[model samples]
Target: MVFISLLGLFLLSLTQAAAGSQLFDQSEVFALLGDDVTLPCRVPSIRSCSSVNWNMVEEFQSITEVVKAGAVTAPGGKALRLDLLKDCSLAITHLELHDARLYSCDIGTLNSSVSLQILEVTESSNPGVDTIELHCFLNTYRGYAPCNNKGIRIKWRSGDSKPINGDRFKVVNPSECFSKLIITKKLTDHHRKWKCQVTQDDTVKATTSYTTTIKGGIEEVFAAVGESVSLSCWATSSLGGKGGGKWAVGERTLTHDMSPHNGPFHVSEDSSLVISKVSALHAGDYTCSDSTDQQRGVNKVRLHTLDVTSEREPEGDNVTLACVLTCTKECGKDITLTWSGDSRNSWQSRSMKVNNLLTNSLFLPVLSMASDEYTCFVHRDSDVMASKKWHTANPLQTPAWVVLPLVLLICITGFYLYNKRKHPKDAEHEQSSVVMTPLYEVIQDVNNEDLQHQRQHKRGTTTTTDDFYDLLQAVN
Candidate 1:
């Protein structure tokens, strides 16, 4: 049914042309929407025209002549005029929906017919999505009209003028039926809408809108210490199969074998970042993107390095301990490295001038005391990001006098053991003889006292006997 309707429309147009006094067929003119177009009627002889009349028909309704003898008389004739010398044609400016009807020029026994144009605007944009071009297109039509199509007459606009074109816009090609308009300015803003209106016969036949949007992705990420995290990204399916992915922190490129980072971060084939261990160094802004296609697919995720570390020197007068604040990537600025401990009152910090320096650390000096604890905290302003602890050993000391007895005792024991081992029998004999000499002296003294006492008693008894004898003799 659709094919028959189109065929009937074609035949009816031909039959109507035969009604004119002349039978000249003129090709249809192509024009972009909101542009100017000229419909031509010519004679083979190129003679002066007695009179050329331009007439139009609406759908199937016949209309009066829009122009006659090179004079403008149409509703849109202000911008229209006739060029009637070798050829007599009607020109219309700023064509509209009303201009889409069949236009015919009538001459003495000679007539020419042409239909206005239609165009389909192709949408195009640059790689950055910055510049966009809307160009009109049309299929081939017989220079004269037997078939009519819609696409050519379109008006492009946004909140601006209809059929917009200016310094910010460039119209490389403009026609009553077909045109190409480029937006040269940068379109970085979001959710911008453009419109295209198709018109014919002074009425709007179709209106459409072309909208451009700025896509958004993940802006930041929070990764905890010791917890695995992935910086999410999306690579266009258009990427080549051989394409590889990488990550970036500041100026440093993250690699699978970044040994300095303990090989904790690696990027997948899809450009996603997976950190097996989130360390202080690994906490920072990371860009998950493919190395090949840099612009089309790119994203950044900030990793807050939450891990902390500490180191302490051996016990001494001024024990030095350190709290390290670092990450896989250089955290931009505004970081606070703090020191705190049980010996806080007596301890001294290295220097607070270490602010914003790439090397972030807090050195704490503690007086050598038993079990002194020190804590270091990292902060961005008042928010503490990480902290660590360190303990110092007590001072070790001993006096020479206190050690003398121990040294002498050890020497005596060593000398005796050496003599006994070398001459075991001689050492045992000397030890017994020295012990028995005191016992023998005690026995000799006891015998001498008994002998003295016996002698005294004997002398006394003799004296007594002598006395008795003397006394007896005297008595006789």
Candidate 2:
């Protein structure tokens, strides 16, 4: 009997894993205003899925049939099964705000896949930043419940010192396991999610949550090399050090001293990251969290930094310069780009931007030879966004050209030193050959028998990279 029970438990575990292996694995699915999204559902047993049904986990946790066997089962519902045999996924078309709810797909197994849907707040275009709303949700042992429970406390305060309580923040319970807290006020704080925490046994634990977004905030910033940049995650200074915060980029988190940020970055007591000198490495997404949120694990932070880059190429006698700004859709508007350094007066110019791609490109053709240096400037209205400097150079006078000469010099010096080690007297004229015009090309034509002897002694039949260049050209 014990053996049979152990086998049943093992099988149940396998079924649970198999059920969660499909799609986002019950992760929250965020929808926009008008998204035709799919609340994917995959059954554990494909063979039993011919009659398997998709159901909405309603207010009382009751199952309302949605679709069955690749067909809609509910009347007036736009839900459809992706496939019966290959997939048990459900597709939701014309998604609405209320559609963000819990769902499950059962295929006659001990375990089934479940997911919760939520709508992401749309970015408001309203001026004055006067109107702001905070949407808060709650969850408890009894599933999602109201936010006004005796032991329940909604922690949705922002970095702004102003307290949000009473009628300003209204808590409404439309259904079980769901509560919406609506607040109307002028907010200058960064967009953040409401933290739903429950206090029990003199200890607090976080529960179900709803995210909020801020409008008309600067989400992207571009900085020039050597320029100072201040990235504010949230104005936590007003919290009176009652809480600490953490900053992170990708998987790496920040500590007391900056390691990955080699460009001299400092964290102010106010929880703002101040980069004194920006470099190419400083460009990427930055996220921060109030240390108080570590318990809740609600990571709500945003910042985009892109360092400027310049490219130049041969164009007859002059050079064609391309100044590119790598941006993203998160970058806000009021972008004004300018150019300088080439003219006696600072030159103002416009950059062509593509919406889908956050790329901004400004091209300057046939810049006069008299120009010593060139620079590109970006601004959001009067505030300087970023600046990149480009020094004017003649064709074949670029950094690549500089590197070519240095590499050739190193090769020649090594060859000359090898010759000097053995044939001390022959090294006399080697110095003169090094000073010859077009020195790199001159080494190829040099008929120095001593150098040739050294080459023969070191390696037989020199291997040249020039032939591989032609091979690459052929492939191109």
Q: What C-alpha RMSD separates each model from the true structure?
A: 34.4, 23.4
Best by TM-score: 2
The count of residue-pair clashes in candidate 2 stands at: 3
Model 1 over residues 320-389: C-alpha lDDT tens digits? 4544444434443445566664545555566333332233344445443434565556654223445555
Model 1 collision count: 32
lDDT of 2 by residue, 216-322 (tens): 34245566656788776563435546326577766788776773456688777777777787665666666666775454333333333434454545544324455
**Predicted structure 1, TM vs. truth:** 0.29
The TM-scores, one per candidate, come to 0.29, 0.32
Give candidate 2's TM-score: 0.32
